[model samples]
Target: ARATVRNARALAQALHDRGFDVLAADLGFTRSHTLAVRVEREGGGESVAQRLAAVGVIANKNLLPGDTSPKHPGGIRIGTPEVTRLGMGEREMVRVAEILDDLLHRGKPPEAVAAEVAELKAGFTTLRYCFAAGEAAYRYYDLVGRDPP
Candidate 1:
């Protein structure tokens, strides 16, 4: 729980530092393992979420304050439990933020960002505290799933 919160806070701060407009700056970004980011400039939550997904970042678009519809949200919610379970810490959170910045703010190509994301994901394929590690976890990158042991 502690680690999850720590990483989530780190991620929120990093995202904010990149001028991403992370929600809840007064509440320390988040107290749990998740945070919300408003992407009004990048075409709202739904569009930005889809762009992030194109580069392999998994996040859900949800309606923010004053937003009327869930289908077209104004914010994207991100969580850190999966990466934290894979042994990611504050440093990796910063890396995640950098990737987001590059894609969202710096105008990097989706293909390039996808390769960078794949590289970052490759480092965490081996999950800690698990006997089967990569085999046990869902292969979210290439969609290659193992049947069973």
Candidate 2:
């Protein structure tokens, strides 16, 4: 939980540094909810996630209005522990951190993220037993599966 919070804070700070108005708030009124981010915009062209990503924030869709815990909610949690297990160093962690912000904020199209997710799965050579690659694929799958348009 601490690690997740740290990741969230780091992501928020990165976004703020990159010219993004970061919203530091909890979402969903549940124990296992999540932290949320709302990237303020002007013309309203990009999706909230996309706008946030443009700067560096990765807003989890599960986040409602006030929640914390990635175990089973909207907050997308990123932890360095897994990368560390995979033999990734600080620099790699930073890069993965950047990727987290990108994956969340980019509001990647289902197809695009899906492709990325596939590549990520293929890259999971460490059998280090992490969840990001798989979770990413599942999330993208769910998103694509629920496409209403």
Candidate 3:
């Protein structure tokens, strides 16, 4: 739990440093694992979310305060819990920001960015913050019905 909080702060800082306008910066960015960033300059939240998703970085399009339309929100809400659970830390957050910058700002192709994401994810396949270590984060669908040996 403590580690998650620390990682979240680091991730938020990393994103902010990479020129993403973090909402509520006056409030220390965030108290929880979630960080909301205003991406209206690069593109609206939904558009940016789509672009990030294309490159395997998932984030949500969110409606900032005073904004009404869900279809065209003003912010992208990101969280670090999943990555934290995957054993990523502050340094990894910086790497993620670089990938995002390359994709969104430098016009890198989705395939290229996705390869980078995959390479980063390769080392953190086991789940953390759970009851057991060495457990696979994802289940093979074909093996779902089989019992563990």
Candidate 4:
């Protein structure tokens, strides 16, 4: 609870530091992953993820209708998973936000982005996504007469 309060305060400070217009947060999720950020858009120059990163907040932006990238829309989806995998704590999550922001908004080349993606993946390789495992999980669920696993 103490850590949550601290992080919350830091997030608020960070948003204020970045000049976000509105910065309300969600509290239902057990972790920061559920947080949402809204910033005043400026002539296609400002973006939600950029604001969050300025304040060291990592978040996911939902795809605009029909958009289909891990990042879309104007939302930043952040969580503790990657930090935990990187052997980091809450503070590191804040730092990770910097890396995320740079990659997303800077329009860095795909190869450079892919390399960072690989590092992040290496941190949590267990869920690296395996086709065989997916098929098996699907089969198990199907055996129980469930929808696609």
Number of the predicted model whose lDDT against the real structure is largest: 1
lDDT tens readout by residue for model 3, 1-33: 777777767777877888888887777888888
| lDDT of the candidates, in the order given | 0.87, 0.41, 0.83, 0.42
Task: Output the number of the TM-score-best candidate.
Answer: 3
Residue 103 of candidate 3: its Cα lDDT?
86
Model with the higher TM-score, candidate 2 or 3:
3
Candidate 1 lDDT tens digits, 1-149:
78989999999999999998888999899999999999988889988998999889999987899888877889999999888888889999999999999999999999999999989988875666455565635554445555411
Query: Which of candidates 2 and 4 reaches a greater TM-score?
Result: 4
Steric clash pairs (candidate 2): 26-65, 26-66, 26-67, 27-65, 27-66, 27-67, 28-65, 34-67, 34-68, 62-74
- The runs of at least 3 residues in candidate 1 whose Cα sits more than 4 Å from the true structure, single-residue gaps closed, are 130-136, 139-149
Candidate 2: RMSD to truth: 9.9
Model 4 C-alpha lDDT versus the unseen true structure: 0.42
TM-scores for every candidate against the unseen true structure = 0.87, 0.35, 0.88, 0.39
Q: Once model 4 is optimally superposed onto the true structure by TM-score, how far is the C-alpha of residue 45 displaced, in angstroms?
A: 15
- For residues 13-127, write the lDDT of model 2, one tens digit per residue: 5544544444542432112223333332321213444533544334433443444543334333223444334344434434444554444455555455545444543554352
Instruction: List clash counts for every candidate, in order.
Output: 0, 10, 0, 7
TM-score of model 2 (CA atoms): 0.35
Model 2: lDDT of residue 33: 21
